[model samples]
Target: MDFETSDKVKLLQEQIERFMVKYVYPAEAVAKQEIEASGDPHHEPKVMLDIRAKTRELGLWNLFLPDPEHGAGLTNLEYSPLCEIMGRSPLGARAFNCNAPDTGNMEIMAEFGTPEQKEKWLQPLLDGEIRSCFSMTEPEVSGADPTGLQTRAVRDGDEWVINGHKWFTSGAIGARFAIVMVVTDPDAAPHQRASQIIVPTDTPGFNLIRAISVMGSTHGGGHCEIRYDDCRVPVENLLGPEHGGFMIAQARLGPGRIHHCMRAIGMAERAFEIMCRYANTRVAFGGPIGEKQFVQEWIATSRMEIDQARLLTLYTAWKMDIYGKQVARQEISMIKVVVPNMLMNVLDRAIQCLGSLGISDDTPVAAMWREGRSLRIADGPDEVHKMVIARRELKRFA
Candidate 1:
């Protein structure tokens, strides 16, 4: 893989770096204040709207979509480094309309939606005029196993009726639309018995129960508990083929996991910066904390891990460019396990170094720490990725 950045990618990285410093970082507090005052996590903040406008004006919109006509059309390798810069500020990705759940939903529509679907949904999403979510995990079942899903979508001539309960359906509470995965052929083979359907939020019987908070934050945009109580939509809303939902989910998640790793590396970088800044200025034992051997060790090790994770992410991106996502599964799974664990370590050290301030909202450390914890389970739990890695290894030996 070529290690040198193309001039185009270098320009993108520089632009994103400046945007994050000049705009996103300053807006972070304002966003929080808006969310708090509204007491509605799902409400889009005015500051976010302003940021979105600026991002769109800068031509940074829809950078994740690989299709040139629909988005920036950059290769995965080209997009990886730019995403990392956006990752530095957790909210910056969305400001550029590249945030997850939405990005995954957009990719699904781009790849599978009929032209009409694209015209009504995909275009608005690309334009940043609306948002979306994916609902697949069921609270009552072991969601790690897709075959264990209990949600059902049944056909009725011109319409399909969906009935199920889903929680941790990330980004549902305020999204204008959702791509739902449901069992359409329970009697069929386990893996091939499900399907994906696009459901509008205003459809009858579709309900958002509440935002399910994890580790104390409401995750603005809302990871929610949802119920489709006989919610019905036209047959035209089905995405991909009947009983083909699993493959589509996998395709969406492969890129999703890599994006998480890219952002996790960014989060770790931010934490290290915060750690170093605090270490140098804060005095303890009659000297700067940076003078302490243990603090210095933490800083040095953080640099090592963050750099290593970034290279792994880049390599995965390069492989995807050359061999496609299927051939690069091992590399994707490897970073899925490594990056989150590494970030956990880095964030823990940062929290310790910052003393009480890290645990508090005074710095962004508290929020960063929460996000690192979530990465362990979000896309696929670490255990699931490890299992995939082990199976691939055994195949090698065979």
Candidate 2:
């Protein structure tokens, strides 16, 4: 197990890190100001578009997708470190067009979309001309279990009419279309009961209720509430085979987890740096706070936790690259549970070290904490992943 990155990947790492320092970090405040000035919390910031053009100019775009034609064609292991750098600043992912919901959406579409779907929806998304969302989690169902999804789509002639209330339809507000997971056959097996359908946001019955505030902010393309009231789309809009929503969604989640965990590590690393910088410069007890045992312990523990999470995440990426996502299921579940919680631990310590400023939005640490709090619940909750990890372990013993 050689751990060295290839020269190509090493070059990408250097470019992305340099890009972060020069462009993304400075654009953070500009993004915030643009959003504020727009009078719409969910407005697409001008800085986002500016940096995207710059990122394209630098040949740093679409580093997430593994497809050679549309993306950088890098393997999962190669993409992991780059994603961590993008996760450091909140603006980082969009600047590189590697943002989520979009990344996962692009993956599934590139694999399953018909040629027309690719031309109409996928290309624009790939070119950064439009954004899209995934509509799976429903307001009425427990999000942890996708089997309990309640949305319904019934075939009527050439159209599939859809009806449901979905919240956390992430990125829905500005999306051009939604890849909707709906029940096509109620009596079919749980996994086969649903299918994914593409519905243009302008379709008559699709309603954007509002962006549900998380941790007191609804910035960017917010996590939106959408009611699909007898929404109709061409039957040809179905993605993949009939009853394939579960499979497609599962595929999206498997690799996407690696991206999420890496980004969490990046955020934690930034917070860790902020915490240590404060400890070195901020005097307490007639000396630097770094001299204190408690502060030192926080620093030491955070260092260990961050490195552990990164190694485990990178291992999971390597396993996915070497074997496949199915083969790496246990490790995937483990990191899905481990990394986000590890991030919270590191962020909590950093926040405590910085005291009031850590809780304030003046620094990115507080916002990272606010957003990272949801990581524990998103994708799959820790309890759910823990249950999965234990079941696989018990089966091994059995």
Candidate 3:
């Protein structure tokens, strides 16, 4: 694959790096303090708003959507590197309006939403005026198996009533709306039995129960458990087709997984840098940890894994760009498994190398660890992706 980046992409990447150093990374501590003080997990600190404003002013906003009229109009391959640069800091994606749930939701709307739907929802989303969420996972059942979903949506007159319990509904607490999956026809084929409907967070029967923490941090816009007790939405809220939710979910998730991989690599790179810095500055016994053999080995290994993951992700992006998401499913699944696993290992080593400080938020390693670990379960989970890869290979051999 020709991985040569254009001058425009390179210049944008350099500009993003400068932006990260000057504003994004520095705002991390300030954002944390604001969240803690406000006692709101969804608190967008003023500093974050300023960064977002600056990002929008510089025309760096909504860089993830591939639609020219809606977003920056860059393809997946072009956006991949930009996303990786944003992934350097936890707040990076939000600064550019390129963060998760929102990105996937925006793509869905851009691709499938009707003109009115796009005008109402997609416009606000692209503008970053309001955030959104995806609710597909259930409190019960293996969420990885989309066919096993139990949330039900039934049509009643001009409205659709949704009933289900959903957890790990990422960004639900802060999201103004959600594109939710519900079974409209369970007797139909497993893959075609469900539908997607937009549920406003303020809908009468829809409930946001509480934020669920991963690795003990509830302030990082924690995953939420939500209940929809006959939550009714207008039939106009239906996205795509009646039994088309599963297909749309699949479409949304493929690119979504790539974005996750890109950001995870950036986080790992940051962790590796921190690990090396700590090794150089922290003296042990008579010399710096960098002088020690085992520490050097860890640093070396981190470099190797980071490089490998980045290459794999780039190849996946390239494949998607040239061959389309469906044709590149295997490569995408491969990185779906590789990127997080690589980052998890690198982060764990970095944590160990940092001693006790790494396990705490005193450094971003701890938060990075939490996020990277959760990724193993997010998207499709490692085992599921492995199954996809193995099946694809076995089919080819057969």
Candidate 4:
């Protein structure tokens, strides 16, 4: 229950805030122009590279990983606030090498990979020399229930041949490799039928089918659809134990969900600021919009909702730090559903407050709004999280 900020975390948070203000926020516009000019939604703009360099120089790189040997040695509680700051800008997380798929992939490697596997893939990912993607969702199955995934990985002498169609493979376009989930034991228990394996993007039969659009915009490093038709990797590439994919995936998502919630809170905070500023300054019906009771109510409700979501998220991070991911599953599921819905509401009011400008690209609200909407689906849909929470609560009563 003690969520007090440590001195090291406080210093790091201040440094991250300063970095965001000076570099990340400013670079957003430059990165947008570069991506637009390149005519590719997934293009990694040169300006982003510069920002990454600056983040490294400031020692803000890899803030997400808790491994002392490879990362900042910060706990989930400590990293929570830093994640919120980065969430303020879409480019914020990547600039510091704390972005998703990479973060989750790195954790899996550190926790489960063989030494050789770590040397080849994990090291490059940690160094930010390469990027990665997680391919778990399938086109034919309901993504919410990963146990129903149909991707197959069959043993073939020294190699594992993988055949699957995966979509919503985030960050696949620029990723050098993918952490793929495949059904290796179709006859095994449903929960233990699949295993995770590392598939190099260059491996034979591995294909990046296309980058799927979200809310009409495919942001850089777009979510992708991938086909692995007889894709092969060495036997040593299996992540964790055989038929252990479900366990690894659950572990990966615990922190990932928290990271998403933290960023959503930051996005909501930014939207709230914009909404309040616009309402205070804009004239409506011969008076400032802030003077109206309805506008004031939106501002008040937004502030309350943002703080509520933030406190819940921080509390969850603290629980994960104090207890373990397993013990904090209920809280994780709770925030996964609560924070995104809260964010959507806040963003909607912000958009309404800004009038026509809110829905346009002239401001970041529209883009953030779209991202907020996607948060409901990504990292396990809201319905799935709700089911988890309900099951856990029912077990308590039983």
What value does the lDDT take at residue 374 in candidate 2? Answer: 92
Report the Cα lDDT for residue 303, model 1: 94
Model 3, range 47-115, lDDT digits (tens) per residue?
A: 998999999999998988778888887878888889998998999999999999899999999888999
Per-prediction TM-score, please?
Answer: 0.98, 0.99, 0.98, 0.98
lDDT of 1 by residue, 230-295 (tens): 999999999988888999998898889988888888888888999999999999999999999999
After superposition, the stretches of candidate 4 with alpha carbons farther than 4 Å from their true spots are: none
Clashing pairs in 1: none
lDDT of 4 by residue, 1-398 (tens): 67678899889888988988888888888988998899987889998999898888878999999889989898888888989999999998899999998999999899999999999999999989999999999989999888899999999999999998999999988889999999999999999999999999999899898899777877877899999999989999999999999999998999899999998998999999999889989997999999999999999999999999989998898899889999999999999999999999999999999989999888889999888898999988999889978998899899
Pairs with steric clashes in candidate 4: none
Residue 305, candidate 2: C-alpha displacement in angstroms = 0.4
Q: Candidate 3 versus the native: TM-score?
A: 0.98
Q: Number of the top candidate by TM-score?
A: 2
lDDT scores for all predictions?
0.90, 0.92, 0.90, 0.91
Collision count of model 4: 0
lDDT rank, highest first? Answer: 2, 4, 3, 1
